[model samples]
Target: MSRRRFTIRRPRGVAEYGAAALVAAAAVSLVVRLLVWVGEVLVRWWPVVAVLALLGIAVGAWRAAAAAREHTARAQRLSVLRFTLAEIDAMDDRQFEFALRDLLIRDGWSARQVGQQGDQAADVIAGHPTYGRIVVQAKHTKVAAKVGSQVMYQVKGTAGPVHRANSAVVVTNGSFTRDAREWGDRHTIGWADRERLRSWAELGVPLHQILQLPTLARRRLPGTRQPFPAPYERTAPEGRTNGVR
Candidate 1:
């Protein structure tokens, strides 16, 4: 059997090919100019040619720099997005409310938690003395079970009597209904959906730190079941005894 030899070919990108073509064109033009000079018929356009060449180099460098900056920005945004998702996943309903309130406070708003256990409409009331009062209803539902128009109306109704605020803001871990968003728009209410929450979390905190909260709790008590002791066990601790008394 005869063995066939395979040749490897290198691939060149458009930018690489374009740069090569530019260098080749410049070399060819220089050679042509040299030939014309030898024949004593060289054009007196050296200054113009020099300026064009400089312009071409500047444009190429600028394009390369712009492309690099775009790539870097995309990578940073992706990193931020991943960090935000991790933070969201680590948070429970109460923790999420705390995080949201912290973010609002960081943004220079005076935030106060209302009735955490049984709040009718708003979970938090945040305000800037100049920007007026803003009512915040922070919901930590799964992506599928999002707050809809009913919840929005409920909040609006509850907020009307509770506080005559300037604006009502619903911040949730999931998204809002299209109708809900439209209703908010019509009623001049603000909706901070999942994307906005994620963006804020990314800006305010790191993912590693957020994830570390649960990990730290688990590490503090190795091999321990939660709810500490079941409710039944708490009521009947003696029931588990093998012998009497």
Candidate 2:
């Protein structure tokens, strides 16, 4: 048996064939010249090129690692915030009020709880730097339930005559209605909306750390009574995916 040989066919026209061969030869020659030039450059400046290449690789790797770490940290913070939000929603009225008041105190306010009887709809009274005495009404609700105009009216009315507050603030673990927000904007009422609450939850030893495990108690360090686990474990809430979407 004879083996058939494969061959590349050329253009039949003489000028066309010559042009194609010349183009192909030129491309090959250019590639050869580029390779020779690269080799010569490398041989002449190998030390500098090697150092620069290593430096470039190191920089690229470092930047990539830094970006990845930042992304991971951001994801962890978001997770913690979401869990804290769910925990806030899970809180009862009194718990929610106290937490909000505590957050106020963390921000350098002399916050007091006044949500009991005769409190006049004011859950917290805070000494603001600018507003002097400010009142906050807390509403911890489902994400979809918006704080309506009635709540705003109560906020204004109770804060004005009853508490003699300088600023009436409406804080919610959820969101605010358009009318409620509009009224607040018009009346110079401060609002700690869900995003603000979420930001608060990201603070040191935040509500995420205070959350009860299945036993309705804070997850404590194994050897000690500390609510936080090891530093790494503290970054993520354990066994809870039912957080904000």
Candidate 3:
């Protein structure tokens, strides 16, 4: 048997070159038609595309501005004020309550002054997203005149049942009587005398840290009823509109 071999050859002349040119021209024509269709479509819908792009940019800018404002407000709230003990002492009772309410707001609580006649021992009601609700009693008095245990008695009796407070505190610009301190300790009520108040108002110590209260597990005491649904007063300062969660 004889083995046969085959050889491949390139196109020889004009006929072959003309066929190749026809294929290339067809390809170019197809590409040009496709590009023309795309360009017409883009020209016809250019206004809509531009509007969508502008909308996207406006939405992104709005979100970024909102985030920046939130950050700035948070920083302003966290910044410590230059408060002095003399300033605190000079404040009237109502002014003192408002000052403490502002301090609570600075410390990230939605707080307002409620100290008035028939306030039920709650001078301030504050709510935190993490720590729940707290009631504060403010006493503005001279250093020589000390806050007594009666303040603690009043707070312990009414803070939970009347105001639905998770924690109760009495803050004073004067010293606390020994009996007052003991009473607050016994009942788990927090008392901040002049020095402690200075630390909180001036040094930016958070009230929760000073009170030593737990953050999570916002549970009521055994046999205690649920907190009142309408704990916040209608007049929330700084445009806060809602009650405690």
Candidate 4:
């Protein structure tokens, strides 16, 4: 018995296969003309066929390049989001509040951190400076932590006179309970959940500027080069205490 060997060719992509088909059809038509006179008909339409084949290849290449570019952009956005989340996780409570405050200010809202020492109900109060104020409760917590209805109630209770401020806003790093969200909806309080916070951070909004309240005094002392120090620092002068030196 004799053994026969055969080789198989792999299929080409759309552009390659289309070009091959166009070439083969032209060659076959020319061959037909040599045997008969039908080749003239094929030759007459050859320019149109070539133009159509080239147009098809160009369209396919454009679509492929567009898809590749879209995937690359999406990957880049994901990379940026990951880095932003890492930074948020690393920030201390103060820093997180500062960042949130700055974001509000950048959005054209005036903000102030209502110190816990006072009868303040919210962590920050923001407004349009001239129109009204919006109470903001900033919660810097781990992923496991959650904001409950009680926090929402407290913010609503502390939002000053209705004539001065129209609404309250609760901002948190972790998600809020369903009950909390329902409470906010019922009371007309705005909830800025973890997703919104993440979005703001991704957009590169500054949170520190929101804490710059006008009533707060700006002071600079020793060990500080800047003319004004952050308002959150201790107000007492250096080396001086309430009683002891």
Candidate 5:
């Protein structure tokens, strides 16, 4: 049997107290030195920092004002500008896409012209609160020309999968060939040919009214191959067809 003796310790002495005081004083001195160093840095670089801050603020304000002006101008144009087939035909491909974007905007949807070198077949993308997202492929061509099935293939392949759009459409100031129309119909791809374009752009028909969409307006359109009539079956050489790709 063994009994253990326990001892209670208190602060060592003045040396220990002095050491603790020295540590506290050193920490305070270090903090004060750090603050002074930081102050000196701010003083030396204040001009450059101020210039950068002013430049950033100026740039941000300029961009905001510019965007506001552009939006106002666009809204004005949507209300006032008359879009004719002749005017559409006169436009380049890029301008044609912009026209589509404006038309979408006019119809109470947020729209943007996304056509470029690598646009992934989406010339104009739009969203509506009720009708959901739509992706369009703008094919600008002569009245005599037609948009081919290749364009439909492009839009159908990319619109739903890549762009996450609820509807995929190929729009043209020209018409779609029988093959193109048939292919589009089979794949649930919408066609906005010259007639439909006139209705949407010129006559101010809402897009949802012009196109035959699924009954479930708000649902995401399923990309499926449905049966569509292919009349007057014929094939032409890829480059020689009287259609724009």
Candidate 6:
């Protein structure tokens, strides 16, 4: 059975107004009495209340400021990630190498590009303050293309030895195949995939700054090659006329 409940309607004239005003007055009186009680309490324990209140305010302000700073940092990182992804997507192979070198310099490295017609195409050579010297192999591939094991091996074998590098890294705008990544990991050769590269650009977190490989941090001993041998002045890669990408 369907049933409709009847609602009692309140008069919409002076009676409603009078009832509302009475309720309002009673509410105000209750609030006033509460405030009076608080005032009396405060008179007795004002020192304790003041100290607690001030401490609470300070803690709240510090937390709010910290949260605001963290929020701003996250927003800035997201903005940079967007711009970096766009640039990486558009850059050609040569542009990618030189750009990587520039990024290394910005993140506190003496960086240069290895320009050669045939040398396994080892891209950039840079020196890290903490990690010493490291050779780079840059691969600017389409997003879907996965860097394979053969290329990973070539760079792993060549980049470090050819330049007398303490360690080697392969930088890619595309991702690596599982086999390639595993091979590199086993050999202590590092790589930066697309998303990782974006974080590097966005957060100013350069690779050379973070690796914990004992060999990477210790090489370039007293008489050996300088951590940063003559940083080749920055320049566009050879045969670049069409501009970026």
Best by lDDT: 3
Query: Which stretches of model 4 miss by more than 4 angstroms?
Result: 1-83, 129-131, 162-164, 204-245
Clashes of 4: 10
**Model 3 TM-score, all chains together:** 0.58
**Rank order by lDDT, top first?**
3, 5, 6, 2, 1, 4
lDDT of 3 by residue, 165-235 (tens): 78889999889989999989989899999989887776666778788877755555345474322344434
Query: What Cα-based lDDT does every candidate model obtain?
Result: 0.61, 0.66, 0.78, 0.60, 0.75, 0.73
lDDT (Cα, tens digit) per residue for candidate 5, span 113-224: 6678999999877777677778888889999898888888888889878888888889898998999999988888999999988877766666776885544344433462
* Candidate achieving the largest TM-score: 6
Candidate with better TM-score, 3 vs 6: 6
Global lDDT of model 5: 0.75
Q: Clash pairs of candidate 3? A: none
lDDT of 6 by residue, 1-245 (tens): 98999997765999898998898899999999999999999999999999999999999999999979767755653443223667768887878877777767665678888846785647777777666777888888989989988887787777655676777888788899999999989988888888778767655554654445343444454455664767676567566432221
How far does residue 232 in candidate 6 sit from its true spot (Å)?
A: 2.5
CA lDDT for candidate 4: 0.60
Cα RMSD for candidates in order:
17.8, 14.8, 18.7, 15.5, 20.5, 8.8
Residue 155, candidate 6: C-alpha displacement in angstroms: 1.7
For 1-245, candidate 1 gives per-residue lDDT tens digits of 99999995543898877888898899999999989785553257766777888999999999999979756754554443333556565567766665565555545456666636668877777655445556778888887666789878977886656665556778887889899989987875677777776655554432222222122121111243431211221111222221111
* Global CA lDDT computed for model 1: 0.61
Off by over 4 Å in 2: 1-83, 129-131, 203-245
lDDT of 2 by residue, 1-245 (tens): 99999997768898988999999999999999999999999999999999999999999999999979756755655553333777787877777776666665544456666687777778877654333566778888888788888888877777768766666777788898888888877876767678877766543333222321012232332345533211211111234332334
- Which pairs of residues clash in candidate 2, taking residues 3 or more apart in a chain or in different chains? none
Clash list (residue pairs), candidate 4:
98-207, 99-207, 101-210, 102-206, 102-207, 102-208, 102-209, 102-210, 103-206, 103-207
> Could you tell which candidate, 1 or 4, scores higher by lDDT?
1
Identify the runs in model 6 with alpha carbons over 4 angstroms from their true place. Answer: 1-83, 209-225, 237-245
Q: Name the weakest run of 10 consecutive residues (lDDT summed) in model 2.
A: 228-237
Q: Which ten residues in a row have the lowest lDDT in candidate 4?
A: 236-245
